[model samples]
Target: MIFGNFVSGLIILFERPVRIGDTVTIGSFSGTVSKIRIRATTITDFDRKEVIIPNKAFVTERLINWSLTDTTTRLVIRLGVAYGSDLEKVRKVLLKAATEHPRVMHEPMPEVFFTAFGASTLDHELRLYVRELRDRSRTVDELNRTIDQLCRENDINIAFNHCGHFTSP
Candidate 1:
């Protein structure tokens, strides 16, 4: 009878709704699932660190699973451009970059927001959904590179706050 119960428990544990290899965020740490044992699970952190967490803790903790049956993830990119830059042009460039990226999702579409007016620059936010979490880094790199190239070609300057600026007259 004890052996039967143990087998049943194992079945229950293995049949959990959360599957192996899901991208999950527990507390503030986010990682990809490496293994799902009967009693615990192993996840590989973004920095390649391994974390072993008990299965029971997952039941009681708040976990954000990015790939639960659906492999879509939302990404937000924030930028601060100089005050003189045209808002419409900035939005167009950011949206164009996000949509043109290979990893970005097209069904949900990309959006750009004029977030805030700061002392020196205008804060903008770009949001897009990606279907693959593994390609996040590459997508971000491409997006930033595109943004920089577009800004340079259009003569739009990204903003940075410094202590002082010396002008030669």
Candidate 2:
């Protein structure tokens, strides 16, 4: 097993699947690569915990290196509006919110999709992209706040689950 791991490490070094500082998701673990050794590689997850993964796993398992080709990442925001809300207005509000955000990449052109009609609401999805992974969290937060404000101003009611139970007396 040690020999196999050593060989796997050598493969990883040569193939360059992941490197120090690369943000990656390997199976259930997602983090930045902190160190790479012949026998193992260390990753620092978002919570600041260091996780050591066997070199063999790198060679054997699937990995997603978010920073590999480009740092540009896409974000999807899903929202629903109460039934009877104007669909056209909702689309416009979503587009305005996304396009006005400074961190959003304009070249890709944000899009809004009327995904489905839920039991009690109309579902919509806003898809947009950001230039860097570092901007993801802040961008999402600001966009959500902006969207909420915009929806309220437009008199659109964001939908929520409504449950009613009737018991026979």
Measured by lDDT, the strongest candidate is 2
Q: What is the lDDT of residue 166 in candidate 1?
A: 93
Give one digit per residue, the lDDT tens place, for model 2 in 1-169.
8998999999999999998999999889999999999999999999999999999988889988999989999999999999999999999999999999989999899999999999988999999999999899999999999999999999999999978999998
Looking at model 1, the pairs that clash are: none
Q: Write the per-residue lDDT of candidate 1 for residues 9-42, one digit (tens) a residue.
A: 3653666645677889877778988877766678
* lDDT score, candidate 2: 0.95
Residue 36's lDDT in candidate 2: 97
Q: Which stretches of candidate 2 lie over 4 Å from their true place?
A: 167-169
Q: For model 2, where is the 10-residue window of minimal lDDT?
A: 55-64
Candidate 1 root-mean-square deviation in Å: 4.9
In order of appearance, the predictions have TM-scores of: 0.83, 0.96
